[model samples]
Target: MMVNCCGLLTSQKEPVPLKSVEVELEVRDHVATVVSTLSYENKEDKPLEAVFVFPLPGDAAVCHFSAQIGQMQIVAEVKEKQEAREEYDDALSSGQQAFLLEESEQSPDIFSLSVGSLPPGESASIRLEYVTELAVQADDGLRFCLPAVLNPRYQPQGSGGGEGGNVQVTSVQVTSVPASLVPYSLSFSARVSSPRPVSKVESNCPLDPLQYLNTEQTQTTVKLAAGHKFDRDVELLIYYKDAHQPTAVVEAGRASSEPGTLMGDPVMMLSLYPEFPQAVMSSVASCGEFVFLLDRSGSMQGARMKSAMDTLLLLLKSLPMGCYFNIHSFGSSYEHIFPESVEYNQKTMEEALKNVAEMKANLGGTEILKPLKHIYSQPCIPSQPRQLFVFTDGEVGNTKDVINLVKQNSGSHRCFSFGIGEGASSALINGLAKEGGGHAQFITGTDRMQPKVMQSLRFALQPAVQDISVKWDLPKGVSVIDLSPPITALFQGQRSLVYAQLTGQGSEASEGCVTVRYSLAGHPSQNQLHFSLKPAEDTGLTVHRLAARTLIRSLEMEKREWRGQEDGGDKKKKVVELSVQSGVSSAFTAFIAVNKGNSEVIQGPLVRRNVPTPMVMACGMRRQCVPMSYDASPVMNMMALRQAEPCSLKKRSLPKQPPRDPLLQLVSLQKASGCWVLDPDLAAALGKTSEEVEKPKPASVNQEVWATILALIWLHGFKMDAQEEWELLAMKAVSWLQAQKASCVTECVDAGNALLGCTVQKDVLGL
Candidate 1:
């Protein structure tokens, strides 16, 4: 009954006086707005400064921040980060209460919030709001994840210093407390509405039964169930009947803002979901350079390591023949499966599979950038499109730096990224896919990684969409400016959002149209949306804030690209300007609030408190696999990291975890040629003895061909519900048999079906 919490920086042994957290989430279509109110009370004998470093969704844009201390309510304003920091420090020195919120330069998703000079017996409430677009999951569900702030994010070596150092957050030791003795409480609620009917809402946490707000089922409300731990991530998968419907929202400008500015001008958020023709989608390309980059970091122990091995099995078997492929595993350094890219035929695939089976979570630390450089440095094979598949736990410290590298080499290949566990950095996963023009998938909780990884693999095999353009067709004389960057690549059922500024005056009744055109393989496709120029009152500043964030990220990237140039500072200035204008939090800007009304003298020295990363449960007992805290200073933090033990989880008293997946056991028996050898392992995976399974083999067919047939029938007949996960593997097996042109395939299939107690037809097995 111990809840996990991310302990913050504190001068004292006890944590900060955080009492409760209240969250309200609203989802309209694919966009979500979350408002969190944290209640704190100073129960200490003296004044305390509370600095909390926490995680937010990587792509969320903070648009509002404020604090309520006693009867005084102080609204914060966005300013330059340094200026805000100085003001907060100055306020604390003056013995006045102040609040500061700044995004971490090391990772945009990590934010530092400092509440200074809270006198004893005083209470304060902090309100924070942000908006983000939900990512589509493998099953067409829109996924929204509230990350667990308590999980440790491993900092790469030589990081956490200088201007954008990881020094802002220093973890302190904290222990698990029973639920009955917990210091804080959490309240969470969500309201959802979409153009399509909401089919259902699911979460890893227990939730109250969803209540429909309307008969159409488009509107509903849900909240966490009673006694929820509020630990781990709160992941919600919202399924809709027709989620791909194209829609547009035009939000009204702020009444008090300048007309020419981002906040004053009406912003149109157009959503385009293109469903490609099945004819094109069904045709998988036979040629591509497939590079799989894996994280063998020590943190990928236990369940994570097993998940990676299972996913690799699927990926290795799913490769199309004649394609070039290689496997790279990285931690402190990287190792490759081959000297270079090799043709994925019988011989090469077996060598790769054998080596992959021997992989372990022994590599030292999470050092992703090094291996990425190695992958990108390789020259692309001629006549083969480069498709890079990266799998990681996303514990790296340099999120932006890694993303920038991906962006620089984006033109060379498409990168499909998979975040492997509960705490994967959404920023890293989303950024890689966005910049590399591919798709991103996340595997969380007990979810099978194979289906999601296989989905991305399918996307990688699809013909690339090129020559993309967004055409604005607004009312004449009412000019428009596109706030979003150009369209990159579009996949079936994925939502593409385009935000634009409507500058010139237009008739309220007049329509504004936008069209997105792209070439898929050789065929041209276009999707368009038309909306009235009249502002949408209910939407308020949601669309505008989202637009501002898009522009800010682009500017930040530009600022990085132009660094050391004369215009570098100018570009940075523009980013700060826009951030202030739109009232959105950015890397260059922070939100600061000061309580000028407090006139009390200093009670004690200022101290900051953060929620400590909690001790995780291990081996069915309350134990820690590694140190959960570091020194609360930049220098000491680095020292702690260097001295910290790798999480090999080598506890002497603990039993070994079952690593091999049951399904993977079957997949592991697959030969490089996609055929299963008639062995005891194969029979065991089939839940039979070798003597029993071998009895059904046709004399004309070889052992491998018959074993492969039985595997296909087992997958189709018994595991049809998991078709998506093993569809490619089954296809590979059938292809191997088809290559033999064995007329006895029918006899083998029927006999294998009898042995496996499955009545699967040969056609159903895709033979």
Candidate 2:
């Protein structure tokens, strides 16, 4: 979640310093370089100071920060956090123009910026640049998000608060305000180039038609519509002809920097897409211990609660019969469906489904750590690997603590996490998956959770990739120093990135090969890529900055693990040194810029102003925005952001009927064994009467077998596009039909396909 907003301004009519923002996005392959420029004007009588806080992607490496006042410009320098703060204070006291930016001590995703000693009637421009890799969506699209999380985090007492106990988050009360009401102007543009052909681009926000630069369709440009306001999150999903191709980019280092340093040498980024054998992929595992953790916090009141329940129903119905499973929900406290995980059977599944239906968002606040700790404490079932599925809106205050706990127990279990709703913490969601040897997915803005959830479940069922190692083979006199941590998990078609330093000297025409070796389900295999060592032309220091950020994060995690030990200090020093050398902002570093051009020191008492930002949102296009009103100011102090409690009368619980969804209706009729019996509900789901479906059944086929085949055929015919959501359950049904060993299986399939008006073949339905 990354949002830029001011706190508040005195006299709403008074002009504020911050006026407008313009952003440029340059995407080269999977990496993105973003540049944002903000224009501010001080219209007050005396010299004043302004402070603003905002959110950023947790993994982004902020590489540049600068400010321009009139004709003079100052480029900020990255320095130790304490030293930068002291310099900022000294410059402010001396009445010199200064700017300071630093990450929160507790939350990496939040930062504060202060502008000091700005003279009256002066205009200034601030520029910030960063680089980050895009996340790969389940459908193979590359996802880039300009995230806007207006909702303040929800936290309870002692729910993962950090050592820096003073946490403050500003919230403004309003519904969906119109974009025109916002004071600031915004413009966004993007240029995308890829090795593969650019198929298309889609976004949650409206964009001008994509313009291709060449006939090959490898390069293109797109921009936001003229009427777009910087209110809601802006997301872009880019697709390519072959998205799974592996790539390697080698970038040259800065000339002025000394050799043998992170900045002065060549850096290589390897993008590896693992390939799994089809024999293993075709079979879904039926044995595992599946545990689900859900967030029942008060913030998850309406739509979120409904989606969460719908996803749980799909999960419960799709589980393999021999597996063990349990359901856990948490708020300020936690509760479980059973004392421990119970075997997955008809009775247990029914009981779990019934309890799931009754669950609500009435649980007080977000406290996920307790439930996670409890789950990890439970004994792992022998021969049944533990797969933990965690779902939340990601509002916890102790994100680092929770992530560390996941890493500690990562050896025994795999964690699949889902960040539900807008404003979910990317840090918490990505951190849990990265540490627990599983995958993470974010569901937001009309995105269906069931598909993404089922995809992750498939990853969980895939045989684990173990004993992974990366080996680099370069020319003589060239050695490599790996920057990324060791690979712990891999899923078929998922991209894994590796960064390394190219040390020593090599000919410009030298070619190098890198091999990735891993064992999947006891079969040892390897993937190799050979590429030229020549430094890429016109490729800036984006790769180096990202590499530095990765190393810094790995070291920070190590520092946390080595806390109170002598090695921790060394790791901290290394992080600060590398951060300064690479000109990137880290938790231990801050960016500071100062101006001493004004020789006169005739400043009086300086007034401080906090600008207020109203959050006006528009969904898909420029012509439409949510009609409600909202005031979302994003100046944060790494504390829990709870919606200010509204005193209301306690409401009585009502037994409401579940809505009749065609998909869920069909899904619910499938038994635990994955066979559908002939019933009126099943017929209704398939849009036919029970007698009509029963009359055409083959003489050799029983009612159960015919109904099961009909369900499979209907899913293939009507819901083919949503295969990701129902693929697992459909596979189970196919397995059950095979187990029956009916002689007329093909006859039943052909008849069912004709009845459903589907041309699907027996093989396609897995009959």
Candidate 3:
């Protein structure tokens, strides 16, 4: 059997053989020996600088070391450096005796351990005494890399333990540094060829890279400015059955702007919550109304709901007995079992917990807004911080409306949404949290739901910042040009700091400071705190504008889709105008926005009464369908001209669903107040007929198809050839959807509208 191991970086070299390796089982008279020696004759013509990588436990400590080989000695010390450097250094330092090594006199940097030399044809031996403080075995491991050393010849002895005994490399990491830093284009690859077929592939990359890819199918564009610096680790894994093909790569370079405009609002980039410097066992007193709005819809009936209920129970049990709590169950209807401020006595809490456990998924519709609004409307302690946790798959009638309600109803309370399934709407949950000045979390896998939800709830309930303000006290000559809204402070563990982008060049400054102040809930408060600053080293007017514009485009896209108007319905209404006014085609607005680096724009109602502009008229198609076809665009062309960039549109799954009338089949899939088709392909499948098979619309559309339509409208407006025309069909389908039992809401009208009736129903049900 092959012992498989995994690591970060990888290589093409064979695993070193365990020559004369010994595993001692006994430690007698303090003369214990655990020699795990591996030797190999240098077959290649280059010296070997082997880095013995180890995945030591976080609390592991090296005690002593002894090595015998020539006059060469080893060096070791505790490294306190960036995590990246620490990993690299740890691998090289492992196995070398601590006492005999050339131990550093000063505190170790991240890459601290070193061995001077193991000359060619020279054998070296070392003994190390260390103990790992980890309570669990899984936390201990080591990793290393051996690069070709000075002028020497050697080939690492492959795990030549027969065909069945292949050398297994553990904790391997193959990475690439930027060419700007390394001046080289080195690629890393790993091979995990075994007698058995390959089973799995793994990947790890930074959040920015993943966001750039937009794996969530969002039309959002992530931009990097010219002078701005960014570093990210991108890991790609390709698993294959063949030998030597388990390869991965990390690509890094200058990234240009993504096309398709999303208008952005000036926002606070970072939170300014004060860190709870020290935690003590103080009286964890609780006040205010604590509402637990649970998703008890039919979808939540299985392990999803079960896990959520158990988690909620665990949380309820853990709450200090002094806190007030309420339980609300929502589905087709909602039931608030307890009053707004239920006393948390032993009996009351136990009964509430029982009620929660007994609560079952009933009805179907997810009436989220009503419960949230109800919580907001209820009278409660005005000064105490209110917290409402919505635990569900986030399958709601109207997410936008619920968010709006929460925002509007916010008095002294915060709204937190917990998504409990893979299909949970990230946008909805995240938007709700953002809009409500709270936090949103998505919990996947039933087994992990309880722990994840509890963790999120714990943080959500802990307020780190309140009444936060960030002010830029500029120099004498400096002026305040523009700034985005200070973002709501989010808690990071127990501390919070706010960050914002300030744009304005100063000729000279007597003094400059960014002042931040916020209340720390149960902690202390401050006002007008100042952060001194100097002229920004990285200041690019063009890149800043572009970044701002790109953000605006993304926000606009989000808003446009939020207003679900199928059939290019309201395309003529310059409802929301991106600031690129001089463009010939509305589609070019995205290009112009990028070209000019302007982010400020107006959005509200695309008033139809506004003077009919040629661009709007030409592009005035509802459900702006961004062509899924891999074709050139003015924006792409502009990007190419500016930076020689290339972007390809991913192909649609239903290539044949476009041309044909999709309404015919769509109407059939509608079930009264229960099932509604959100996927365009499913709608198209429902719309198509056997007779239409000869000229069936390209493949059918999915929910993403509708999104693409909206994106196209954002770009070209309501302009498309007959073959690409699907707006009318979409309109018909939306009408059918509107008339359907209202379980489904398109990006057209938002999940909020569909839930309005549910809100009424919930109200009637005494939610």
Which candidate has the highest lDDT of all? 2
The lDDT, on a scale of 0 to 1, for candidate 1 is 0.79
lDDT of 3 at 316: 60
Better candidate by TM-score, 2 or 3 = 2
Q: How are the candidates ranked when ordered by lDDT, highest leading? A: 2, 1, 3
Residue-by-residue lDDT tens digits, candidate 2, 1-767: 64424532333344467788798999988899999898888877888777665566778899999999888889999999899989988998888888988876555666667788878888889998989999888789998877554334444455443211122331112122233455667789999999888999998888999999999999999999898866666789999998999888899999998888989999999999988889988878889999999998766766688788989999988999999999999987899999999999889998999999899776656778889989988999998999999999886667777888998898999999998866677778888998998998988778889999999999999998889999888899999999999999889999999999999999889999999999988899888999889989888899999999999888877766886887788889999999999998887999999887768662887777654333322122122212222223322221122232322222556547567778888998888889999999899999999888988899877889899989999998999888888989998898898898888888888888778888888899887
Candidate 2 C-alpha error for residue 265, in Å: 1.6
Give the poorly placed runs of model 2, Cα more than 4 Å off: 1-15, 155-182, 613-659, 750-759
Which predicted model would earn the best TM-score?
1
Q: Summing lDDT over every window of 10 consecutive residues in candidate 2, give the lowest-scoring window.
A: 618-627
**Per-residue lDDT for 574 in model 2?**
91
Candidate 3 stretches with Cα past 4 Å from truth are 1-273, 279-283, 382-384, 460-464, 486-504, 507-512, 521-767
By summed lDDT, the worst window of 10 consecutive residues in model 3 runs over 609-618
User: Could you tell me how far off, in angstroms, the CA of residue 753 lies in candidate 1 after the best superposition?
Assistant: 2.4
List the global CA lDDT of all models. 0.79, 0.80, 0.35
Off by over 4 Å in 1: 1-12, 158-183, 613-625, 632-662, 678-681, 689-691, 694-704, 744-746
